[model samples]
Target: MCRFLEELGVAHHSAGAWHWTSDTYPADAISLRAVTSDNFVVVDITNEEKVIAEVAFPAALLELHEKAIYLHEARQYQVEKMDYPQRKAFVRQVECDYFTDAIDYTQVKILEEFETCPLGAARAAHGEVRVNRQIVGFKKVKFYTNENVGAGALSLPEQEMHTTSFWLHFPDPFLARFSDLTPTEKLNSISGMGNALRTVAALLLMCDPRDFGVSLTEEIRPGLEGFEPNLHLYDSYPGGIGLSAPLYELRPRLLAGALDLIRGCPCEEGCPSCVGPAGETGARAKDGATRILAALVEAGLESGAAPQK
Candidate 1:
């Protein structure tokens, strides 16, 4: 930055420091929020085809995608078609006992690790990352039962953001007990763990749930030191708002709280209240997430270290 400014004749170096000489304010030409003003028009095509609501572009993928169960005024409507090019969603009235949640695949590349430490059976780290994700599908979960009744595929644009995250991965030596589970099962367990952790983290931080995003590590390669499936709780904003560090500091309480929440939930398998809906997460999600958190808390206790907070 110093060299670039020097070449532009707007800055000079003296006393081992770069000094700006420009009389004009540089921030005058900058915009803080570059977010687009575009939004999706939700059209109710049941009778007269009236417009019901307008959803922002950022949230349209998850809420207005095709087959999504949209709720308005305590009434249910099924999205019949989503015209992406036109930014419109066509919906019809429907009486159903289920709601829909979008499914997406995400990959996080650690650009720099701000900090790292042993946290029970796993290692926890907070760092800057590049996240790429897309809305690949949606699942229909029963309203009260929380049973996944159906799902559908979607082809949507991939979104990427640079932010900070708190992540946990188990060491190869520590994964021996999970040998009974398959690779897919292991990843699912991590997904369930991400769900519980994100909820607890949001409550602890007193932030809106949408302020945080949850995802799993890209690959589950065996024999790699700590390259097993892992969970990440990341800031949804382009540059983080200082959430990851606090989460890292409160790791012990975070894990213990998640464990207790899942353990105390009355759901037989898994529900939105804990872990995740069983059908979308697989029937063993609750058990898997509980086992993982319990192990982490136990290991932390054995190490004679209390939560850093």
Candidate 2:
């Protein structure tokens, strides 16, 4: 930082500290959220159009997309149109049996690692990560039954953020245990394990599930041993909400809770309560996730690590 300022001729070195030589207040340039001050305004177009709510840039890509059902004060409002350039969403009140849930694809790149350790064969770590997400579609889920009633495609620009995340990665030795399963099934298991972990993590952290986002990727190598699949639980907000660091410390409890939840679920294969809806994930997602979690726990015990404290 000091070198950058000096290179720009705005700061000078004196008394072993950098002194600002420019007239600007650098604090004003710093922002807590990794975004501009612009926000998308939701306008109620039912009777006479009136401003209803405001959504941040990153969230607007998913929430303010055309055909999305926007909920405000327990009232359902279906988005009719979105003016991308103007950052406004036109919505009208409607009675509907379901709400919209956006489906997005996320990619995480590790920016910096804060801590890392082995939990049996798998490794656990927490760090700053760059998250890029694109909302490709949405699902309309029925209110009472929680069923996926319908879906529609979306075309929106991707959103990116730098946030803190807690991740668990599996190496080649761990992957060897699941060699009997097909490639797709292994990927599905990774996805299912991520889903279960996100739920249990929220419970352990005493925060709403929405506070964090989950993703599965084979791009990161925190262990530096090789490329491996890593399941990440990240803070949803830009920058961070200071959640991942504590979650890293509670790794053992999080894994245990997720395993217990999956094991105790009454559904024979899988359900939203455990791994995921049966067919959506693989047929054996429950078994796969259970095996992975149990192995992780048992490996920890055998090596005297047993996850983390």
In TM-score terms, which candidate is top? Answer: 2
Q: Counting only residues 3 or more apart in sequence or on different chains, how many pairs clash (N, Cα, C under 3 Å) in candidate 1?
A: 0
Model 1 steric clash pairs: none
Task: Mark the regions of model 2 whose C-alpha exceeds 4 Å error after superposition.
Answer: 1-38, 56-58, 73-75, 95-98, 142-149, 220-227, 306-309
Residue 74 displacement (Å), model 2:
4.7
Worst 10 residues of 2 by lDDT: 300-309
Candidate 1's C-alpha runs over 4 A off are: 1-37, 44-50, 74-81, 92-99, 141-149, 219-227, 266-268, 301-309
Model 1 lDDT on a 0 to 1 scale: 0.83
lDDT, each prediction: 0.83, 0.86
Q: Give the distance in Å from residue 184's predicted Cα in candidate 1 to where it truly belongs.
A: 3.8
lDDT of 2 by residue, 1-309 (tens): 889889999899999987999898877776555445677999999999899898877778878899999989999999999999999999999999998999999999988888888976778899999999999899999998889999999978788889999998888778788877776777788789888888898899888887889888776444565547888899998889899988987877788889999999999879988899887897988888898899887766666653333
Worst 10 residues of 1 by lDDT: 28-37
Tell me the RMSD of model 1 versus the true structure.
Answer: 6.9
TM-score, model 2 to reference: 0.79
Q: What is the lDDT of residue 260 in candidate 2?
A: 97
Best model number under lDDT: 2
Compose the digit string of candidate 1's lDDT tens values, residues 63-172.
98988988888889999999999999999999988899998988987888888777655778889989999999988888786677898888899988899999887666
